[model samples]
Target: MTTPPFPAPTTAELAVVSAQLGRTARGVVGIAARCECGNPTVVATTPRLPDGTPFPTFYYLTHPAATAAMSTLEATQVMPELSALLAEDDGVAAAYLAAHEAYLADRAQFGEVSEIDGISAGGMPSRVKCLHALAGHALAAGPGVNPIGDAALERSTWSPEKCRCDDPGAALRDVEASTA
Candidate 1:
């Protein structure tokens, strides 16, 4: 009997697997930090498992200073929008609004308090990178419709091309064509 050929892994599959392995390895390293108050700081490295599954593990330590800072940041950046969204009547709209609000909150909180410990893409800190990753996951996993027409707003409203139509009917035709 002939042996069946194994299927090659796709780029996305390889990425997920690699990420899972990295997270597992980091977990095994027991990543932890020390706080000024003689307390152990929580050092969590959330890595996805193969097939894009999130690891059910989180490293926990008590860093009162870090926890306090994180709490203050969350209250300032994430609470108001969440409050507004909670008051909204439309479930879908509320969810979308909340997601954007949460993204903004995380961005603000992490951007202000976290420092980039090592070299990163776009000169952003590892915390900010992690926030971005979380935001991406939230966007992909959340049950909300993305609003359209936002990308179009980024470009210039008018083009510099000249129009050459003297007749009223021709101008109307041009308008119709352009509109269409």
Candidate 2:
């Protein structure tokens, strides 16, 4: 049996993530990866949301700068280039397929969602679809797990090594304390 990626998110973390996404995060199971400054960079979302929606993208990227960088890459014709590389490179294709399996395995640890049982994000196992999803997976699973995600991160300008959050830790803490 596969283990869940995390226990649960703190209220502060959920608040920060909600702020990052500009919406109350629905299925967040845990903070999958964090920035150098401790803010969430990637979130581990459950396969099924609290409201019963089937959420396929397990590792959801939340950092604004990181998401923007992936968006920039997606906007700049990088998908086709990566798709071409995925087509030509046997190693990459194989690794990408493995990554897809890993993704499904991770989500399966939480619960089975029949709607997304075989679905992994970023058009995984076959084609490149969303850089944000791929990058999120790379950040959560780390390097060498997802070749396409690693490639996307390498092509993008965002770095998890730095903090680009508008307010970072203090604001999130302050808000939580106020609510408490």
Candidate 3:
């Protein structure tokens, strides 16, 4: 059995998530993953939000640094390369299919939504569309879950193993000190 992905988000954690997002977070059900600095990196959102919108993406990437890194990877036009691999390798295709199933199963725990019944984000079970969603899934599900997500993360500049959120001001001061 797969481990549960959603861990209820605390009020303080929600506040930080809202700050990171630069807006109020809606339909956030849980914190799927956290950074080394203890900030929420991936959030599990509700299938059907209170606003009655059918939000299919349950595993939402929340960490600014990680989101920025995924954006950087996307800017590099790496999606085609990843998509090609999905077509060329049977093993990779199988793993991606499994990731789609896992994603659907995770979302189903909240309740079924017909609009997003078989739809998993980032074009899972077929292709790679969004690095942010894929990376979020990998972070939430942990290693060995989302192969494309893992590869995208591996090829990117960021790593969950390192916490870049630590002491931004201190780093700035160091730069100024050296320049002085």
Best-performing candidate as measured by lDDT: 2
For residue 50, model 2's alpha carbon misses the true position, in angstroms, by: 1.5
Sort by lDDT, best first: what order? Answer: 2, 3, 1
lDDT of each: 0.29, 0.90, 0.86
- Ten residues in a row with the worst lDDT in model 1? 147-156
lDDT string, candidate 3, 47-158, tens digits? 9998999988989998888999999988999999999999999999999999999999998888789988899899998989999999999999999999999999999898
| Lowest lDDT block of 10, candidate 3 | 168-177
lDDT of 2 at 122: 96
lDDT of 1 by residue, 1-180 (tens): 221112233333223223323432332222233223212233333333335444322222223233343344344554343334334536534444544444333233222222322222111211111222222223222324211111111121211122111231333234345556
Q: Which stretches of candidate 2 lie over 4 Å from their true place?
A: none
Give Cα distance to truth, residue 94, candidate 3, Å. Answer: 0.3
User: What is the number of backbone collisions in each predicted candidate, taken in the order shown?
Assistant: 0, 0, 0
In the predicted model 3, the residue pairs found to clash are none
Poorest stretch of ten by lDDT in candidate 2? 166-175
Q: Looking at candidate 2, what is the lDDT of residue 50? A: 93
**What's the C-alpha lDDT at position 132 in model 3?**
94
